[model samples]
Target: MEELDEDNMNEIKDKHEIGTPEDHLSEIMEEAEKYHPGYGASVMTGDVLIHALEIKTTSFCTLRCKDCTHLIPYTKAPAHMPAEDLMDDIKKIIRVAKVAGLIFMGGEVMIYPQLAELMEAYSKEGFYDRVGFVRVTTNGTVVPSDEFCAAFRKIKNGYVVISDYGILSSNRDEAAKKLESFGIKVNVIPEDLQWRSLGDWHHRDYSKEEAEELYRKCHGKLYLHLYRDHLYHCYRAPVMNEDGLIPHSDGDYLDIGSMSVEDLSRRLPEFLTGLSCTKSCFYCDGFHEQSPFVERAAQL
Candidate 1:
């Protein structure tokens, strides 16, 4: 290959920079229309199926990891989400698609009081059979009660996913053993595994096309979330919205409670793959895995 001069290199790098915010927004709107067509003209729910659905059961976290995607430390006060409302949302979701699994998450899911009850109720409603997997994510801070373990065991493919934060977490091993003793499956994400920053407080500088390319390459794009009765298309949108980092307006998510099942089907693909980037993407680091992995959950 021929060598590129300094000027050529600079020119190539410049191609990636996003223009002014006004211009960027204009580009996004134009591209959204191209891919999604009618842009926000109607509610068209139909045959949209989602693979994994995330439920934030609580916003309380015992450990404050400096780089939490959920922005838990920024929370003014911890709050428990009523399990009844969550069940109602899940009911709305299953009507749209055959979800492969449900991910119960939080600042730390174990801290949620209604966890066992929610798991048992979802299991009784045939969610275990319908989705095939039920995963509860925890930061390894607290040990779960025996009643919780019993409820987890009742699901056909239920498991606990412990984020092993090394020195920061005291009870990881104990919690895993406790669940396994009750015949529940446990999967531990060791401290060594790499977690690429979903954009650490700054968005990647990218042209509209470049941002779309990054969105296509992101695995986390599939990790959709449901909160406050709305269905979001990705993991970042809902949490970042709570942080006041992005507009939580109607354009950001689907109102699952009111939209008809057919309307949801028609709109699902557009939400999933239509947009170039949310305004939040500018505040994020984008999915650059080449960035070195920091120690998991370093204290804030």
Candidate 2:
């Protein structure tokens, strides 16, 4: 892996190099086509690169950290995507625009044993190759067991991104070892202590500010934000709270099933705007929050 330098960090914050959301989507789908050519022309145009599928499996979690967003307590368990529905969507994405990959996320996807089955289904459909990678974001509260290892082994490329909240035992070292033992790459995301500052009104909470700065540094680079049923360009671009979901002007929220790669590619511009809803926004770790990774660079 290449080292991320000041210049690199600046570029990422600027978001300039990321290209328009549409272009980004096209690029990823095209890349996916390298492995699966059966994908449709829309796969070459679909905005899967800029748009990532975020599968929210569960609303409840065992850990309740101080800076936890997703407002787990406030969220309710909707419904899990049935095996058939998920498979159908995966097949469509592969046939249509070749998605870069699927991000299996949740309050805790591991808690649901069916997640392994989900991975196996992708493997069976010959769609795994079309998927650039399969990443799962999890808190290192549970270690990978034999069954979990076997499920992931079916997929050629898989990674586990562990968010270390400083509460897990052994500082998550044991869990990392367990996953690596299964021939899986385990990456640990250092806990962002700055999250603690959010609890204090005057402690210079820089979550959103830093995110903007980081966005600018990345040259206006934007990542896809999939929430509820609609997809927004950036994580903070959409408003989904207890009241209702509001989209930015010129932006429309479409059901995932109704959405085509071309439809998303065409709407890239409207998706990237910084909406008014951001005015009262509270930052979550999902966005750019100061982490130990940043702190280490400062010391150097």
Candidate 3:
């Protein structure tokens, strides 16, 4: 290889620096037009499209990792949501908007008792057609069941995102192999993954302009939370809300159970844009680019 200069080395080192806040804003705003800016095309055509949203299936995980932004390790009584309710919510969401990437999230998706039922429902509803793609994450501790393997194969554009934390995620390789054998995509999370620690739950008391800038700049904004029937604009907010760490916000979340198609059409676009920073913003480290790093998957 040729000699690398200082500027070239710096560029490689800061690869994760996605860009400045203006870059993020420009990209989000530009993409908004395609994803029903007024919630128009999806509602009128039935050929739906909505910004990506993640479903929080459970907080129970195999390992109690330190400095988890979701604070998964700190949840005293991590529990699963009623599968029936989640399915209902999924159906309602699919009816209103096209999901970009319908993710099956959890404490440990493999351990969820009613996963088969949810997978069955996913197949039955033709979600494969409605979604851009389907993704399920795992930590490689649980072996893949034949039923789930079959269900995964049924997904037209589905993939497994796995992590290998040595013994903790021992079954990771097996899961990947089995998933691949079934003609499904298996994505191994890179070992050098970077996790930004957002600190403890207490409020930071950020001013309006500070909070707005913080909210607009972070990728946490993209990590929208779908808990119970509400769609929160930020992933950390709902988790922190459930943990009673952050004050509740009526304005920050969408009552998915209450909204009509027209209501959903208008609101989802706004929800995705996340223009107004919520109370969670004040308490959050903003998952900012400059936030301190936590070693990925560091067990408690």
Candidate 4:
């Protein structure tokens, strides 16, 4: 997928000198039709194709990192969705959409009890073609069970992204070794890696124009977070809503469980590409070039 073109967006902003929030939203959505990460119009006309899907299997983490991007620490009542619960949405998504990657993520996916069962569900039964590569992202706090390893090996196109946070993630190496032993691919991110501060749950107080501009500047558009059964343009939507930090807004996300596959195909592009910015955007510092960098995995 191509990155957002700041220059093109700037030209539109400069040329139109858009005034009203409603008007600017309309203009932005119209411009979004041209080209952007989630701006695939083919789903409306031809095929339902999604570049990627980040599925949150669990919100329960072992450590409480102060600057966690997903805001995992803030969730008062974190959850762990069973494989069976997730499979329904998985089945619904793959039914109409050709997903490039099926990413299973969490506060710490390694701790998710049904990891093995989830892996088997996506990797087998001709689901490979529908859902391209499967990925399991972990914080490397714990090693996987033998059953999980066996299931992971069955994935035709799958790998693990394990973050190594020095002493915090002592089992990082051992976990990778275990997965590799099962012939499962692994990518271990360095402990000292930099992280952008996603800020606390508060209103940014940006005006309509500024809010739209902030959305344009953000790079998180590609990080389409599927929380529970709801699909959101921003990854923080789930956390913000779950924690009651933000007001409820229907336009912010799609309730995928209630919608049909055809409804999803119709709304997916609109939801992903059409939105100027979600309410959660006001609370997030965002991941972008101009954003401030911070230390990684500083536990509270």
Best by lDDT: 4
The residue-by-residue lDDT of candidate 3 on 40-110, one tens digit each, is: 23334534455456777787888887776667776666888787877877787787677665678887888
Itemize residue pairs with steric clashes in candidate 3: 60-107
At residue 1, give the lDDT of candidate 3. Answer: 9
Query: What is the Å distance of residue 215 in model 2 from its true position?
Result: 9.6
The segments of candidate 3 whose C-alpha lies over 4 angstroms from its true place after superposition are 1-15, 20-49, 258-262
Q: What is the TM-score of each candidate against the true structure?
A: 0.77, 0.58, 0.83, 0.82
**Lowest lDDT 10-residue stretch of candidate 1:** 35-44
lDDT of 2 by residue, 1-300 (tens): 123456645544443243444565576555445433544344344343333555555555556543343444334344444655556555544554434646676666667556777777766777653566567778777775667767776666567878776755233777788778888777787764222111211123556666455444331123443455545444333333321332233233434556676664454335444332232133322332332112211110
Candidate 4 lDDT score relative to the true structure: 0.73
Model 1: per-residue lDDT, tens digit, 1-300?
A: 022354644554443443343454355334334333443232235545455688988888898766566667766556788999888778767765655557899878898999889887877886533463577898888999887888878876667889888867789999999989998878898876534345454445677776666665554456678866677766777667765655445676788767766787777778866867665555555544332334457667
The TM-score measured for candidate 3 stands at 0.83
Worst 10 residues of 3 by lDDT: 34-43
- Against the true structure, whose TM-score is highest? 3
What lDDT does each candidate get?
Answer: 0.68, 0.50, 0.71, 0.73
